[model samples]
Target: MAVAPLFGTVTLPSAHAQPEPPGEVVLSFPTVGVSPRLELGNNVASEVNLPLPAGMSAVRLRGVIRDQANLGAGFLEVTDDNGTFLGMVEIPPRSARPAPLPFDIDISGARPKGSSLPLQFLVRTNDIPADCGPAQQLVVTDLAAVYSGDEPSPVTIATFFPPVLQRVTVVAPTDADPSEQQAVLTLVSTLTRLYNPQPVQVRVISSPRGTAPPPTGPMARAVVVERGSAGLAVEEAGNPGAFLRVSGRGDELTAQISLLDNELQSLAQVTRARVDQSASHQLPTGDTLTFSQLNLEGRAGVLRRSTFNIGVDRAALGGGRIAGVGVNLLADYTPVAGGDAAALTVRAHDTVVYTAPLNASGRVDATFDVPSQALTQRVALDFEITYTPGQECGPLIAPMEFAVDPRSTLQLVRGGPPLGGFGALPSEFSPRFYVAMDGSGQEQLGHAAAVVAAVSRATSTPMTPQVVDVKAAAEADSGALIVANSVAVEQTSLNPPIGGNRSAIDVGLPQNLRADIADGLGSIQVFADPPRDRTVVLVTTTDAWTLVDPLFGYLDGLAGGWNDLRGDVLAAGAAGTPVDLTVRAGGSDPFEPPNVVEHRAPWLGIGIGIGLAVVAVCTATVGLLLWRRRRTDAAERP
Candidate 1:
């Protein structure tokens, strides 16, 4: 057989023969939707054919080759349908083929989809592209029939391209309903082949009606885009899968089936009414009334005690015909002590509403049907009764209770005293007074005295007992035996010694006293009045002649201060005076001694005068005598 320059010019090993037996290239499908590859012994060549889908105008061929034996070398070059040269490559030899040599070529312009054409890979002797003139053609095959051609006789060898699977594109729902049995099975199977453990995501979609095969069961309502070979086979192999079963509410199903990128659990939402009320009302007597606002159903009742008057807030009373609101009075007002037990008539306005017994510790629920026709404004109830010691009053502390009906205005009369309960005394009526008396005997006791007297009279029915005493002083001079007495009266006047008793003559005595006896009389008066009760009297007697010898004996010291010298009685033994005839005639012994005024005065005067005269005479006489004697003595001395 003859050979032409093709494939690549084959290179011979420096240590080996010129021609090497033709090597085989095998192509196979590894993954759908993926480029196909060619298998060469222990090495893999990348996919040589990238099929363009139906409308695609271009295809790309790419692959890799391992020299394997260090001794073998070859060249690679491609040619189009017309046999025009396009591009070339040199496959270098390695000590051990180094590694795989990779190559890619644009086959788009060379061939279009659905076109049966011829393409060639020529292998030759040189490892360099330019050294290929003598190169031999390794293969020449039709591209469309590349998959299954028989052997040809020639000095060189060639083989058809290997078979690769076609990938089908489709759309499917990411979140397929679980009840879709067939759809679920088909999806699961396809994913299982592609991924060993089965991928978490699988698309199951519905095919269009009539345009594709009818599904066996319910068709998948959702679109399924399958990618793997098994998926395409399973899909294309059977009637396009069934529509998915709808579950529950379509809305709920749609919501649950809608896929989200993040993993989450499905949730639902749903609506419901509730009531609340509980409280206890404590009565003054230590009892409690408990009730619920919600459970009242229709109407309720309550009991109260003691006639202080139980007040109800008119606004809070619900609008309803209280069947005869009447108050019941319990004798002695003793509550039914421990548990709920007591009865009373409750009145709403004039109508007798409810008559129910109250529990000692519990409350009664009195309910009345309030008709639509009933008035719903302010209403009051008044109870009339005679004075009773104690009574259990209905709901009210007092007999009269003012309550307004429901939906009406409230009439509120303030409960207690207007003063808000404060008690205090004013200043004008406070307790206090003033008093006085006239001290001068003139009794000019003025308007002030009258006022005092009026006050005393007003405050007293009888006179209060009072005592008064007076001390009077007397003085007699020269010849008069008259007593000049100063009286100090003591009384409990506001101003004591000066007034009150001054004009009132409690007692009177002779205002004159004999000079000699006046002292004794003064002493008697002093002793007569007690010091704590009354003032004392003092009398002084005087005579005109007492001055005649007042300075005798150099005054003998003053009469009362330093010395106690007595003077001869004169003027009939008066304190100061000349001798009287009666006293002179009786002689000193019997007549109480006559005054020595004349002798005392003259003697003192004469003695003074004579002593002065004697001194003068003696002084002159001695001079005369001394003169004579000196004269005599001088004569004797000579």
Candidate 2:
């Protein structure tokens, strides 16, 4: 059985094939999502990027090949980020077709040479793209590794603690008719924010009566509102820490809001966390919120820094990378000669995409196009300002000051359509954030909450997921996350087109490619279908609820970002199975890949270099020649 990392749980591998040894760190996935239509012989290799487990040592790689077409005389080389040669595996001969070829032997020795963080694999062929047949494909179903190392807990305490923090469900009574959505959002928002702060999201559920609670055993959290017949009771998970609670008896939204407000105050009093009650300062979704809304100290004064999230719709761009988007900043500042430095910078994922010096005095208007590549579903804009004179300018009494108008704003130009579905995912708050769950199974709700928390962490937004049933899932107006067991999954009217005969509860796959999702494991997939123009992320497991619970950790929407999670479909293999996760990129259409492009910034830098290089060389040559002529004339005349 593959050992469970600190973050997720796993099942034992088939006795016949083992992905992880008895005790070893592992980052195993069912499929690396390498397209089968590999254009062989391009003399160029198609790269399959694989993610590495954290704090792993003495790594060894193993893979199972399901499909290989015309892969004649080609070799696969696995290299670390530094291109260090870890090892290589040769392809089989064409004349002799092999079924499920095995490359189980360790790639290198006990430890790879300079093992890097992320392992990048390059498959080089001695063939040409033009000569390669259309059916020439290479599909690797299972890629796993055994390593010697242990990582600290991957879970960070937020609303609850891990494994419970891993899954928390907010139970709101439906009889409350139009339940206090605002109050619900408030409670959800407060619970989702864990000060220790790891990008974790909490799933908020409003359930009808009679819903069975998740069976005991696995960790789970439930926050109930005591309204009408409802009552408040809390179960502490282990000895994690203390938490505040709110209780009241009323069904109206207003009453609920009051209750939630009280709850926030109680929680803040105990946790030392502040609740921004005057939400009048909270940033709005989309591009509407302005700089004035930022919670700056007494308008503008000493240095201050803050971060906020803005929701975006990538599907609007037809699921492709966007371009020509701009952010306008209106600032009013006064800069002292050299006394201190004041400026405004906008960063995306910690990289400064735009920065302007607070030069001169008065108002300054600047607009810069944020490269589409720099943006994600949950846009994080960091604002930093400093107006104090240099310590060196000390006591010299230089009237150096700076303050930005609340009118300082950000505008995302909608050049064409909306934008595009994110290549990166687990996106933050959108117009609508919904969690669709099939609560029939015991652990379904817990697994669903984990999924929602992952999204919240990824976007660093306090997501309040509107929990709905399977039927409502089909009709959600915006993006949703669906979590259910395999049987429950099949029950959902809207589901993967994997259906079998009326007598059977099996789903079919194209090209005879298959895996048993019902064999006691979980799988997750995201697609741009249903709700038209919105996305639906689905997570399902066979009967074993335990099997799917650990995946939320593997998704690591917090650390990995949506970088590794591309394509429309991803399947996590059953425990001890061949593949840990399988991804089918761009859905069925291999030509039009997912709407993500990595070729932007680096290429732009090269273009800029070339342009500057040409100008520099030309100008330098002319100047040198003119100087030489002048010197020659002077010497000849003398």
Candidate 3:
């Protein structure tokens, strides 16, 4: 009939039908806040602070998923802080716990115009499915855009996360140049502030001969020299070296000298200044002198490049008969056009008095002394001038005082103290003359030291001025105890053959050691003078007694494993007797060995023999004793 419908086996629809999958993911509305601010040249910008609401959150995604069926194929793409695609995770089918979408973005190295990323997701599975209606397609237009600007873009303040700590120590040699010294100081300061590594204190001490007392009287004065006058082609003659001096007629005053290299860099600093004293007592008597060694590293430059101003204590030096005083400059250089013409002018107050042109070869046979007994009974010398290049003559600036009275006994002596010739001082430079206790006077000459402390109050360098007395218990035993302070013992003697004649050797160990000492000779004892000192102690012993050795190895065998002997030995010692031993079972079954039959297990044999014998003896002894005691008691009772 109609293809004979089969009615024998009929199947009906299930209780419920599978719902249709979502069509596409879409946002109800996409809105972007763009302020009225436009950067230069059609640039659009906005200042925005993004934050999530208490109960709501936003997620970013890439590559929209459209499903005509279940619409559950959407997945979220995660990116780094720079908006670079990192990874992606699938959107689970309609489920209770939905996977969270990632929102972080990284935009580093993007194109100049910038790009916007629109995201869409199918909401087939979730507590509240996303409405993917036809009008819900999300279009986030111009999400982010940046324009390159002429000025560097402003950098946002990053989180101030601190770094891990580290320690470092730096050592600077005394012979380093000034620039290097400065660099070291800077590095030390920076490290201290950054990590606070304990800094070691450095003390630089120098002793040069002579003395320099602070200038006295209103007329007493000092001279200061600075790098001056460059741009000349003169050669240094005699190279007497540069020096600073302060003196009066007859006797020379003492001062310190610092040498400079060709780069105008200070090379070495010397403090021995010996100025001649027995000179004429005229208006311009040269007396005190301070010398500083310098090596002008050959560098083409004009003088007067360096500048300095002499400091003066007017009230202390501008009184009495010190009136018109002058300062003299000296240089030792070969005379060329600009080099030979270089001469230093002496200036008193604002007036130039003495002018001495450097010699043709830059040698100084005589001092360009100035007279200063005019202005204020006591003169105050304060002047400034440039030293043109090429005049690397002897003593740069020599400030001297002259007097009319020839009966003056106040002679300028080089600083008498051991560390007097450092820089400017209060006294004058005297000849190397000393009054010997014997009826004889000889000249005493030596480099006096100059000590300057450049410590800051905030420095953390140790400043413990006194030696601290420490009190601690020692590790040595009493009664002729022997202790060793970082001493090592010879191993060969301690490890002779087992029964070999062990010779007694003095060692670092306890005096009353259990190991017999061979005639008080072979024994190595660590003797502690006070008997309570715990200094390092080294003991020499036979190799057979070591942990690796058989007899002694058991000691380590009991502790699971052998480790370094950083600590004291804890095993009990036997006085001429065998030491007790402890052991651990080796096999896995502990109760039985793998092949216990053909070869009886060691522990099994022990257990069998002792266990059966104990039973047999106990049973027999009890029966016999009971029988005898019963017989005696029965007889007595009856």
lDDT of each: 0.25, 0.44, 0.22
TM-score of each: 0.19, 0.44, 0.15
lDDT of 2 by residue, 1-638 (tens): 12213322223234395454554754454222123222322233444433333334545666655666656656555555556566555655566646665554343333233323355555566665422123345666566655555432222122233311334455655543223333444455444444213232455554665343342222334455434433222334232322222234333332333323233333422222322222321224454445544332213433323233333333222222233456565655555456555666666557777776665565667766655545555344555554444554322343434444556555544332221222435432342456655654554554554554444434323444565566676676566777766665666555452322221223222222222223443456665553344556777655555545545655653344344554443333334221222122233222244442222111212221132121221234334434654655566694
Which candidate achieves the best TM-score against the true structure? 2
Root-mean-square deviation of candidate 2: 22.8
How far in Å is the alpha carbon of 442 misplaced in model 1? 99
Model 3 steric clash total: 125
Q: Worst 10-residue stretch by lDDT in candidate 3?
A: 443-452
Ranking by TM-score: 2, 1, 3
lDDT of 2 at 136: 48
Best first by lDDT, ranked: 2, 1, 3
Q: Candidate 3, overall lDDT? A: 0.22
| Candidate 2 clash figure, as a count | 22
lDDT of 1 by residue, 1-638 (tens): 01124432222223342342233222222321222332221111112433322122333344555433322455455555565553445555445344444444444446532423345555544433221122222221212211222222111000000122222122323332222322233223222222221111222234332233333321122223322211111223222342222122222222222221011111211000011121112221211111121111112211222212223321123321122222222222233444333454544544555465433433333444222112112223332212221344332332212221232222222121111000000000011111111222221111112112221212101111111112111111101011112232232211111111211211111111111111111100111112222111111112221222322212222222101212212111123222211101111111122243222232222221132121222234334434654555566684
